[model samples]
Target: MSLQTDDLLSVQDVHVGFGEFTALDGAHLHIARGGITGMVGPNGAGKSTLFNVLGGQQAHQGGRVLFDGQDITHWSVHRRAQAGLTRTFQISREMGALTVLENLLLAAPQQPGEKLWHALLNTAAARQHEAQAMAQAQALLERVGLWRLAHERADSLSGGQKKLLELCRALMLKPRLVLLDEPAAGVNPVLVSEIADFIRSLQAEGMSFAIVEHNMDMIAALCDPVYVLAQGKVLTQGSFAQVSAHAQVVEAYLGGVA
Candidate 1:
Protein backbone atom coordinates (compact mmCIF):
# COMPACT_ATOMS: atom_id res chain seq x y z
CA MET A 1 0.00 0.00 0.00
CA SER A 2 1.07 3.58 -0.65
CA LEU A 3 1.05 5.04 2.83
CA GLN A 4 0.50 8.74 3.20
CA THR A 5 2.91 10.90 5.19
CA ASP A 6 0.09 11.71 7.58
CA ASP A 7 0.04 8.20 9.02
CA LEU A 8 -0.61 8.17 12.75
CA LEU A 9 1.75 5.29 13.64
CA SER A 10 4.80 4.02 11.80
CA VAL A 11 7.33 1.27 12.50
CA GLN A 12 10.36 1.02 10.29
CA ASP A 13 12.98 -1.75 10.27
CA VAL A 14 12.02 -2.71 13.80
CA HIS A 15 13.98 -5.61 15.17
CA VAL A 16 13.39 -6.93 18.66
CA GLY A 17 15.14 -9.75 20.45
CA PHE A 18 15.32 -11.43 23.85
CA GLY A 19 18.97 -12.41 24.12
CA GLU A 20 19.47 -15.18 21.58
CA PHE A 21 15.83 -15.37 20.54
CA THR A 22 14.74 -12.92 17.88
CA ALA A 23 11.09 -11.85 17.90
CA LEU A 24 10.81 -9.27 15.16
CA ASP A 25 13.18 -9.09 12.20
CA GLY A 26 13.19 -5.80 10.37
CA ALA A 27 9.42 -5.46 10.72
CA HIS A 28 7.83 -2.50 9.02
CA LEU A 29 4.23 -1.37 9.33
CA HIS A 30 2.10 1.74 9.43
CA ILE A 31 -1.46 2.75 10.27
CA ALA A 32 -3.27 5.61 8.61
CA ARG A 33 -5.16 8.22 10.58
CA GLY A 34 -8.66 7.05 11.56
CA GLY A 35 -7.97 3.61 10.10
CA ILE A 36 -8.58 0.16 11.57
CA THR A 37 -5.80 -2.25 10.66
CA GLY A 38 -5.45 -5.91 11.61
CA MET A 39 -2.30 -7.89 12.41
CA VAL A 40 -2.76 -11.64 12.08
CA GLY A 41 -0.56 -14.71 12.16
CA PRO A 42 -0.18 -18.08 13.84
CA ASN A 43 0.93 -18.44 17.43
CA GLY A 44 4.64 -17.58 17.87
CA ALA A 45 4.50 -15.42 14.76
CA GLY A 46 5.69 -12.51 16.98
CA LYS A 47 2.41 -10.58 16.89
CA SER A 48 2.24 -10.15 20.67
CA THR A 49 5.97 -9.45 20.83
CA LEU A 50 5.53 -6.63 18.34
CA PHE A 51 2.69 -5.30 20.48
CA ASN A 52 4.94 -5.27 23.54
CA VAL A 53 7.54 -3.32 21.61
CA LEU A 54 5.10 -0.74 20.30
CA GLY A 55 3.37 -0.36 23.67
CA GLY A 56 6.78 0.25 25.32
CA GLN A 57 6.72 -2.91 27.45
CA GLN A 58 9.51 -4.50 25.39
CA ALA A 59 12.57 -2.90 23.90
CA HIS A 60 13.51 -3.06 20.24
CA GLN A 61 17.03 -3.87 19.11
CA GLY A 62 16.90 -1.80 15.96
CA GLY A 63 14.77 0.71 14.00
CA ARG A 64 12.36 3.25 15.34
CA VAL A 65 8.68 3.82 16.11
CA LEU A 66 7.21 7.12 15.11
CA PHE A 67 3.91 8.30 16.57
CA ASP A 68 2.03 11.26 15.14
CA GLY A 69 5.18 12.29 13.25
CA GLN A 70 7.36 12.25 16.39
CA ASP A 71 10.08 9.70 17.01
CA ILE A 72 8.98 7.99 20.22
CA THR A 73 11.28 5.01 19.90
CA HIS A 74 12.85 5.57 23.30
CA TRP A 75 9.85 6.79 25.24
CA SER A 76 8.73 4.91 28.31
CA VAL A 77 5.38 3.12 28.43
CA HIS A 78 3.74 5.76 30.61
CA ARG A 79 5.21 8.56 28.51
CA ARG A 80 3.88 6.97 25.32
CA ALA A 81 0.49 6.55 26.97
CA GLN A 82 0.53 10.17 28.07
CA ALA A 83 1.31 11.14 24.49
CA GLY A 84 -1.94 9.54 23.25
CA LEU A 85 -0.73 6.02 22.37
CA THR A 86 -2.65 3.49 24.43
CA ARG A 87 -3.00 -0.27 24.27
CA THR A 88 -5.13 -3.01 25.80
CA PHE A 89 -3.56 -6.30 26.72
CA GLN A 90 -4.54 -9.79 25.65
CA ILE A 91 -5.05 -10.54 29.34
CA SER A 92 -7.32 -8.10 31.15
CA ARG A 93 -5.95 -6.11 34.11
CA GLU A 94 -9.05 -5.10 36.00
CA MET A 95 -8.26 -4.39 39.65
CA GLY A 96 -10.49 -6.60 41.76
CA ALA A 97 -10.41 -4.11 44.62
CA LEU A 98 -11.60 -1.18 42.54
CA THR A 99 -15.03 -0.52 41.13
CA VAL A 100 -15.44 -0.18 37.38
CA LEU A 101 -15.84 3.57 37.67
CA GLU A 102 -12.80 3.82 39.90
CA ASN A 103 -10.72 1.94 37.35
CA LEU A 104 -11.80 4.36 34.65
CA LEU A 105 -11.08 7.35 36.83
CA LEU A 106 -7.59 6.06 37.55
CA ALA A 107 -6.97 5.89 33.83
CA ALA A 108 -7.59 9.61 33.56
CA PRO A 109 -4.51 11.81 33.33
CA GLN A 110 -3.27 13.17 36.63
CA GLN A 111 -3.04 16.95 36.76
CA PRO A 112 -1.82 19.58 39.17
CA GLY A 113 -5.20 19.25 40.86
CA GLU A 114 -4.03 15.90 42.13
CA LYS A 115 -1.17 17.46 44.08
CA LEU A 116 -1.58 17.64 47.87
CA TRP A 117 -1.04 21.39 47.98
CA HIS A 118 -3.46 22.00 45.12
CA ALA A 119 -6.05 19.73 46.66
CA LEU A 120 -5.92 21.58 50.00
CA LEU A 121 -5.68 25.18 48.78
CA ASN A 122 -7.33 24.99 45.36
CA THR A 123 -10.38 23.01 46.30
CA ALA A 124 -12.62 24.73 43.78
CA ALA A 125 -10.37 24.06 40.81
CA ALA A 126 -9.71 20.52 41.91
CA ARG A 127 -13.40 19.87 42.29
CA GLN A 128 -14.06 21.26 38.84
CA HIS A 129 -11.40 19.07 37.26
CA GLU A 130 -12.59 16.03 39.18
CA ALA A 131 -16.12 16.63 38.01
CA GLN A 132 -15.00 16.91 34.43
CA ALA A 133 -13.02 13.71 34.72
CA MET A 134 -16.02 11.95 36.21
CA ALA A 135 -18.24 13.14 33.39
CA GLN A 136 -15.73 11.98 30.80
CA ALA A 137 -15.34 8.59 32.51
CA GLN A 138 -19.10 8.13 32.67
CA ALA A 139 -19.44 9.02 28.99
CA LEU A 140 -16.76 6.53 28.06
CA LEU A 141 -18.38 3.80 30.14
CA GLU A 142 -21.75 4.54 28.57
CA ARG A 143 -20.22 4.46 25.11
CA VAL A 144 -18.88 0.98 25.81
CA GLY A 145 -22.24 -0.10 27.30
CA LEU A 146 -20.80 -0.51 30.80
CA TRP A 147 -22.60 2.40 32.50
CA ARG A 148 -25.13 0.06 34.09
CA LEU A 149 -22.35 -1.76 35.89
CA ALA A 150 -20.37 1.37 36.71
CA HIS A 151 -20.63 0.84 40.46
CA GLU A 152 -19.86 -2.86 40.49
CA ARG A 153 -16.47 -4.17 41.49
CA ALA A 154 -14.43 -4.87 38.36
CA ASP A 155 -13.68 -8.42 39.53
CA SER A 156 -17.38 -9.23 39.62
CA LEU A 157 -17.89 -8.48 35.96
CA SER A 158 -18.14 -11.31 33.45
CA GLY A 159 -15.38 -11.98 30.96
CA GLY A 160 -17.10 -9.96 28.26
CA GLN A 161 -17.87 -7.11 30.62
CA LYS A 162 -14.25 -7.04 31.78
CA LYS A 163 -13.15 -6.85 28.17
CA LEU A 164 -15.56 -3.98 27.61
CA LEU A 165 -14.23 -2.31 30.73
CA GLU A 166 -10.70 -2.51 29.38
CA LEU A 167 -11.83 -0.77 26.23
CA CYS A 168 -13.49 1.87 28.35
CA ARG A 169 -10.30 2.44 30.31
CA ALA A 170 -8.28 2.78 27.12
CA LEU A 171 -10.81 5.27 25.78
CA MET A 172 -10.46 7.37 28.92
CA LEU A 173 -7.00 8.33 27.69
CA LYS A 174 -8.55 9.96 24.61
CA PRO A 175 -5.95 8.16 22.54
CA ARG A 176 -4.95 8.93 18.99
CA LEU A 177 -3.93 5.34 18.24
CA VAL A 178 -5.15 2.25 20.09
CA LEU A 179 -3.39 -1.11 19.83
CA LEU A 180 -5.95 -3.74 20.76
CA ASP A 181 -4.68 -7.22 21.48
CA GLU A 182 -7.59 -9.56 20.88
CA PRO A 183 -10.38 -7.46 22.37
CA ALA A 184 -12.84 -10.27 21.65
CA ALA A 185 -10.91 -12.98 23.41
CA GLY A 186 -12.87 -14.64 26.24
CA VAL A 187 -15.98 -12.73 25.15
CA ASN A 188 -19.18 -14.52 24.25
CA PRO A 189 -20.41 -14.52 20.67
CA VAL A 190 -23.17 -12.04 21.46
CA LEU A 191 -20.81 -9.67 23.23
CA VAL A 192 -18.27 -10.06 20.48
CA SER A 193 -20.65 -8.30 18.16
CA GLU A 194 -21.08 -5.57 20.71
CA ILE A 195 -17.30 -5.16 20.96
CA ALA A 196 -17.07 -4.97 17.21
CA ASP A 197 -19.73 -2.30 17.14
CA PHE A 198 -17.92 -0.38 19.86
CA ILE A 199 -14.67 -0.53 17.90
CA ARG A 200 -16.46 0.74 14.80
CA SER A 201 -18.00 3.55 16.78
CA LEU A 202 -14.60 4.60 18.08
CA GLN A 203 -13.11 4.42 14.58
CA ALA A 204 -15.82 6.75 13.33
CA GLU A 205 -14.82 9.24 16.01
CA GLY A 206 -11.32 9.71 14.47
CA MET A 207 -9.35 7.10 16.43
CA SER A 208 -7.00 4.70 14.69
CA PHE A 209 -6.40 1.06 15.65
CA ALA A 210 -3.96 -1.75 14.96
CA ILE A 211 -5.52 -4.94 16.31
CA VAL A 212 -3.91 -8.34 16.86
CA GLU A 213 -6.44 -11.13 16.70
CA HIS A 214 -6.69 -14.81 15.82
CA ASN A 215 -10.31 -14.55 14.72
CA MET A 216 -10.36 -14.16 10.98
CA ASP A 217 -14.02 -13.24 11.05
CA MET A 218 -13.39 -10.31 13.35
CA ILE A 219 -10.45 -9.18 11.24
CA ALA A 220 -12.56 -9.46 8.12
CA ALA A 221 -15.34 -7.46 9.68
CA LEU A 222 -13.30 -4.75 11.39
CA CYS A 223 -9.89 -4.37 9.69
CA ASP A 224 -9.33 -2.67 6.38
CA PRO A 225 -5.73 -3.47 5.41
CA VAL A 226 -4.70 -6.76 7.04
CA TYR A 227 -1.05 -7.67 7.71
CA VAL A 228 -0.07 -11.32 8.03
CA LEU A 229 3.08 -12.08 10.01
CA ALA A 230 5.00 -15.31 9.88
CA GLN A 231 8.27 -16.17 11.61
CA GLY A 232 8.42 -12.59 12.90
CA LYS A 233 8.20 -10.87 9.54
CA VAL A 234 5.37 -9.47 7.46
CA LEU A 235 4.34 -12.04 4.88
CA THR A 236 1.76 -9.95 3.12
CA GLN A 237 -0.60 -7.03 3.70
CA GLY A 238 -3.67 -6.03 1.78
CA SER A 239 -7.42 -6.01 2.11
CA PHE A 240 -8.99 -9.07 3.73
CA ALA A 241 -9.82 -10.64 0.39
CA GLN A 242 -6.45 -9.88 -1.10
CA VAL A 243 -4.37 -11.17 1.80
CA SER A 244 -6.58 -14.21 2.31
CA ALA A 245 -6.19 -15.12 -1.34
CA HIS A 246 -2.42 -14.83 -1.38
CA ALA A 247 -0.86 -18.27 -1.86
CA GLN A 248 2.02 -17.89 0.57
CA VAL A 249 -0.15 -16.28 3.25
CA VAL A 250 -2.58 -19.21 3.02
CA GLU A 251 0.18 -21.77 3.10
CA ALA A 252 2.16 -20.16 5.90
CA TYR A 253 -0.44 -18.57 8.13
CA LEU A 254 -4.00 -19.45 7.05
CA GLY A 255 -3.47 -23.24 7.05
CA GLY A 256 -4.30 -23.63 3.39
CA VAL A 257 -7.60 -21.80 3.75
CA ALA A 258 -7.79 -19.22 0.98
Candidate 2:
Protein backbone atom coordinates (compact mmCIF):
# COMPACT_ATOMS: atom_id res chain seq x y z
CA MET A 1 0.00 0.00 0.00
CA SER A 2 1.13 3.52 -0.72
CA LEU A 3 1.95 5.75 2.24
CA GLN A 4 -0.19 8.76 2.84
CA THR A 5 1.07 12.22 3.53
CA ASP A 6 -1.02 12.38 6.69
CA ASP A 7 0.50 9.23 8.13
CA LEU A 8 2.03 10.03 11.49
CA LEU A 9 3.89 6.77 12.00
CA SER A 10 4.88 4.12 9.46
CA VAL A 11 6.59 0.78 9.72
CA GLN A 12 8.27 -0.50 6.58
CA ASP A 13 9.24 -4.16 6.13
CA VAL A 14 10.14 -4.65 9.79
CA HIS A 15 11.83 -7.85 10.90
CA VAL A 16 12.70 -9.01 14.39
CA GLY A 17 14.12 -12.34 15.54
CA PHE A 18 15.70 -13.81 18.67
CA GLY A 19 18.24 -16.60 18.56
CA GLU A 20 16.18 -19.04 16.45
CA PHE A 21 12.63 -17.82 16.93
CA THR A 22 11.22 -15.12 14.70
CA ALA A 23 9.04 -12.74 16.68
CA LEU A 24 8.25 -10.45 13.78
CA ASP A 25 8.87 -10.76 10.06
CA GLY A 26 8.51 -7.90 7.68
CA ALA A 27 5.76 -6.25 9.72
CA HIS A 28 4.46 -3.03 8.24
CA LEU A 29 1.63 -0.64 9.01
CA HIS A 30 0.82 3.04 9.35
CA ILE A 31 -0.91 5.11 11.99
CA ALA A 32 -2.70 8.16 10.65
CA ARG A 33 -2.35 11.54 12.24
CA GLY A 34 -4.89 12.10 15.03
CA GLY A 35 -6.41 8.64 14.54
CA ILE A 36 -7.11 5.80 16.95
CA THR A 37 -5.53 2.86 15.18
CA GLY A 38 -6.43 -0.64 16.43
CA MET A 39 -4.36 -3.78 16.28
CA VAL A 40 -5.90 -7.14 17.16
CA GLY A 41 -4.64 -10.67 16.91
CA PRO A 42 -4.58 -14.01 18.69
CA ASN A 43 -2.11 -14.75 21.47
CA GLY A 44 1.53 -14.76 20.24
CA ALA A 45 0.57 -12.94 17.05
CA GLY A 46 3.40 -10.42 17.49
CA LYS A 47 1.19 -7.56 18.69
CA SER A 48 3.30 -6.77 21.74
CA THR A 49 6.48 -7.29 19.72
CA LEU A 50 5.29 -4.68 17.26
CA PHE A 51 4.47 -2.31 20.10
CA ASN A 52 7.92 -2.80 21.57
CA VAL A 53 9.45 -2.00 18.20
CA LEU A 54 7.33 1.13 17.91
CA GLY A 55 8.14 2.22 21.47
CA GLY A 56 11.88 1.67 20.90
CA GLN A 57 11.94 -1.07 23.56
CA GLN A 58 12.71 -3.70 20.92
CA ALA A 59 15.05 -3.15 18.02
CA HIS A 60 14.12 -4.61 14.66
CA GLN A 61 16.72 -6.31 12.51
CA GLY A 62 15.35 -4.58 9.43
CA GLY A 63 12.82 -1.82 8.92
CA ARG A 64 12.31 1.88 9.08
CA VAL A 65 10.17 3.50 11.76
CA LEU A 66 9.09 6.91 10.69
CA PHE A 67 7.47 9.15 13.29
CA ASP A 68 6.00 12.47 12.20
CA GLY A 69 7.68 12.07 8.84
CA GLN A 70 11.12 11.65 10.46
CA ASP A 71 13.20 8.50 10.81
CA ILE A 72 13.22 7.26 14.42
CA THR A 73 14.37 3.69 13.84
CA HIS A 74 17.64 4.49 15.58
CA TRP A 75 16.16 6.65 18.35
CA SER A 76 16.43 5.65 21.99
CA VAL A 77 13.45 5.15 24.27
CA HIS A 78 13.90 8.51 25.98
CA ARG A 79 14.39 10.18 22.59
CA ARG A 80 11.13 8.67 21.34
CA ALA A 81 9.29 10.02 24.38
CA GLN A 82 10.85 13.44 23.90
CA ALA A 83 9.61 13.40 20.34
CA GLY A 84 6.04 12.87 21.66
CA LEU A 85 5.82 9.10 21.21
CA THR A 86 5.05 7.16 24.38
CA ARG A 87 3.56 3.85 25.40
CA THR A 88 1.86 2.06 28.32
CA PHE A 89 2.15 -1.59 29.16
CA GLN A 90 -0.43 -4.35 29.51
CA ILE A 91 0.39 -4.27 33.22
CA SER A 92 0.21 -1.10 35.26
CA ARG A 93 3.71 0.17 36.16
CA GLU A 94 2.68 2.39 39.02
CA MET A 95 5.23 2.79 41.78
CA GLY A 96 3.62 1.09 44.73
CA ALA A 97 5.13 3.50 47.25
CA LEU A 98 4.45 6.70 45.36
CA THR A 99 1.26 8.66 45.91
CA VAL A 100 -1.10 9.01 42.94
CA LEU A 101 -0.30 12.69 42.52
CA GLU A 102 3.40 12.06 42.85
CA ASN A 103 3.28 9.38 40.19
CA LEU A 104 2.08 11.91 37.66
CA LEU A 105 4.51 14.51 38.88
CA LEU A 106 7.35 12.01 38.52
CA ALA A 107 6.45 11.54 34.87
CA ALA A 108 6.74 15.23 34.08
CA PRO A 109 9.52 16.07 31.62
CA GLN A 110 10.90 18.87 33.73
CA GLN A 111 10.81 17.00 37.04
CA PRO A 112 13.34 14.25 36.13
CA GLY A 113 11.62 12.06 38.81
CA GLU A 114 14.81 12.16 40.94
CA LYS A 115 13.25 14.72 43.23
CA LEU A 116 10.59 12.45 44.64
CA TRP A 117 12.33 12.65 47.99
CA HIS A 118 12.34 16.42 47.89
CA ALA A 119 8.68 16.37 46.83
CA LEU A 120 7.79 14.19 49.77
CA LEU A 121 9.78 16.45 52.11
CA ASN A 122 8.03 19.49 50.63
CA THR A 123 11.45 21.04 50.01
CA ALA A 124 12.70 22.28 46.65
CA ALA A 125 9.43 20.97 45.20
CA ALA A 126 8.18 24.52 44.89
CA ARG A 127 10.55 25.43 42.07
CA GLN A 128 8.76 27.06 39.16
CA HIS A 129 8.84 24.02 36.89
CA GLU A 130 8.02 21.67 39.75
CA ALA A 131 5.05 23.82 40.70
CA GLN A 132 3.88 23.85 37.08
CA ALA A 133 4.27 20.05 36.93
CA MET A 134 2.25 19.77 40.13
CA ALA A 135 -0.54 21.83 38.62
CA GLN A 136 -0.53 19.70 35.47
CA ALA A 137 -0.55 16.54 37.57
CA GLN A 138 -3.52 17.80 39.56
CA ALA A 139 -5.50 18.49 36.42
CA LEU A 140 -4.74 15.06 34.98
CA LEU A 141 -5.56 13.25 38.25
CA GLU A 142 -8.77 15.22 38.64
CA ARG A 143 -9.83 14.49 35.10
CA VAL A 144 -9.39 10.76 35.76
CA GLY A 145 -11.24 10.95 39.13
CA LEU A 146 -8.01 10.05 40.89
CA TRP A 147 -7.60 13.46 42.47
CA ARG A 148 -9.47 12.25 45.55
CA LEU A 149 -6.84 9.55 45.87
CA ALA A 150 -3.91 11.83 45.11
CA HIS A 151 -2.40 11.42 48.55
CA GLU A 152 -2.96 7.65 48.65
CA ARG A 153 -0.26 5.16 47.77
CA ALA A 154 -0.61 3.90 44.21
CA ASP A 155 -0.80 0.27 45.28
CA SER A 156 -3.94 0.93 47.26
CA LEU A 157 -5.95 1.74 44.17
CA SER A 158 -8.17 -0.76 42.38
CA GLY A 159 -7.06 -2.46 39.18
CA GLY A 160 -9.13 -0.08 37.08
CA GLN A 161 -7.88 2.88 39.06
CA LYS A 162 -4.32 1.73 38.50
CA LYS A 163 -4.94 1.61 34.76
CA LEU A 164 -6.19 5.18 34.89
CA LEU A 165 -3.12 6.19 36.83
CA GLU A 166 -0.88 4.54 34.25
CA LEU A 167 -2.60 6.41 31.45
CA CYS A 168 -2.51 9.69 33.29
CA ARG A 169 1.17 9.25 33.90
CA ALA A 170 1.70 8.75 30.17
CA LEU A 171 -0.29 11.91 29.51
CA MET A 172 2.06 13.80 31.78
CA LEU A 173 4.45 13.86 28.86
CA LYS A 174 1.82 15.49 26.66
CA PRO A 175 2.52 12.99 23.93
CA ARG A 176 1.46 13.32 20.32
CA LEU A 177 0.84 9.59 19.91
CA VAL A 178 0.38 6.92 22.58
CA LEU A 179 0.75 3.20 22.13
CA LEU A 180 -1.71 1.51 24.48
CA ASP A 181 -1.18 -2.19 25.08
CA GLU A 182 -4.36 -3.92 26.17
CA PRO A 183 -5.96 -1.00 27.99
CA ALA A 184 -9.10 -3.07 28.58
CA ALA A 185 -7.51 -6.37 29.47
CA GLY A 186 -7.81 -6.31 33.27
CA VAL A 187 -10.35 -3.52 33.52
CA ASN A 188 -14.00 -4.08 34.39
CA PRO A 189 -16.62 -3.41 31.74
CA VAL A 190 -17.75 -0.08 33.18
CA LEU A 191 -14.26 1.23 33.73
CA VAL A 192 -13.26 -0.07 30.33
CA SER A 193 -15.88 2.20 28.89
CA GLU A 194 -14.57 5.05 30.98
CA ILE A 195 -11.06 4.49 29.72
CA ALA A 196 -12.35 4.35 26.18
CA ASP A 197 -14.09 7.69 26.71
CA PHE A 198 -10.92 9.21 28.05
CA ILE A 199 -8.99 8.03 25.02
CA ARG A 200 -11.60 9.37 22.66
CA SER A 201 -11.50 12.74 24.37
CA LEU A 202 -7.75 12.82 24.01
CA GLN A 203 -7.99 11.91 20.34
CA ALA A 204 -10.52 14.69 19.89
CA GLU A 205 -7.95 17.06 21.31
CA GLY A 206 -5.46 15.96 18.55
CA MET A 207 -3.56 13.19 20.33
CA SER A 208 -3.16 10.05 18.21
CA PHE A 209 -3.18 6.46 19.47
CA ALA A 210 -2.33 2.96 18.40
CA ILE A 211 -4.07 0.43 20.66
CA VAL A 212 -3.47 -3.32 20.85
CA GLU A 213 -6.51 -4.78 22.53
CA HIS A 214 -8.49 -8.03 22.62
CA ASN A 215 -11.63 -6.16 23.43
CA MET A 216 -13.56 -6.14 20.16
CA ASP A 217 -16.16 -3.88 21.71
CA MET A 218 -13.55 -1.21 22.23
CA ILE A 219 -11.86 -1.79 18.89
CA ALA A 220 -15.21 -1.43 17.16
CA ALA A 221 -16.05 1.70 19.05
CA LEU A 222 -12.82 3.67 18.89
CA CYS A 223 -10.73 2.51 15.95
CA ASP A 224 -10.96 2.83 12.25
CA PRO A 225 -8.78 1.05 9.71
CA VAL A 226 -8.06 -1.67 12.26
CA TYR A 227 -5.12 -3.92 11.45
CA VAL A 228 -5.14 -7.65 12.10
CA LEU A 229 -1.87 -9.49 12.62
CA ALA A 230 -1.22 -13.22 12.44
CA GLN A 231 1.98 -15.22 12.47
CA GLY A 232 4.16 -12.11 12.72
CA LYS A 233 2.61 -10.39 9.72
CA VAL A 234 -0.35 -8.22 8.97
CA LEU A 235 -3.30 -10.42 7.97
CA THR A 236 -5.52 -7.60 6.87
CA GLN A 237 -6.47 -4.04 7.74
CA GLY A 238 -9.76 -2.25 7.38
CA SER A 239 -12.75 -1.19 9.41
CA PHE A 240 -13.91 -3.46 12.24
CA ALA A 241 -16.85 -4.62 10.17
CA GLN A 242 -14.72 -5.46 7.18
CA VAL A 243 -12.14 -7.48 9.10
CA SER A 244 -14.77 -9.26 11.20
CA ALA A 245 -16.22 -10.61 7.98
CA HIS A 246 -12.86 -11.86 6.77
CA ALA A 247 -12.64 -15.67 6.83
CA GLN A 248 -8.89 -15.76 7.43
CA VAL A 249 -9.23 -13.34 10.32
CA VAL A 250 -11.93 -15.55 11.86
CA GLU A 251 -9.72 -18.63 11.55
CA ALA A 252 -6.80 -16.80 13.11
CA TYR A 253 -8.86 -16.07 16.20
CA LEU A 254 -10.68 -18.28 18.72
CA GLY A 255 -13.74 -18.65 16.49
CA GLY A 256 -14.22 -15.01 15.52
CA VAL A 257 -12.67 -13.60 18.67
CA ALA A 258 -10.46 -11.34 16.55
Give me the runs in candidate 1 sitting further than 4 Å from their true place. 1-3, 112-114, 120-122, 254-258
TM-score of 1: 0.93
Model 2 lDDT at residue 69:
84
Model 2: lowest-lDDT 10 consecutive positions = 110-119
Per-candidate local distance difference test: 0.88, 0.92
lDDT (Cα, tens digit) per residue for candidate 1, span 112-153: 435666667877877887798899998888777788988999
> Residue 236 lDDT in model 1?
91
lDDT of 2 by residue, 1-258 (tens): 466899999999999998898989899899999999999999888999999999999989998999998899999999999999999998899999989988888898855565666656777554767878889999998888889999999999999999899999899999999999999987899999999999999999999999999999999999998999988899999999999999999899964353
lDDT over C-alpha atoms for residue 243 of model 2: 98
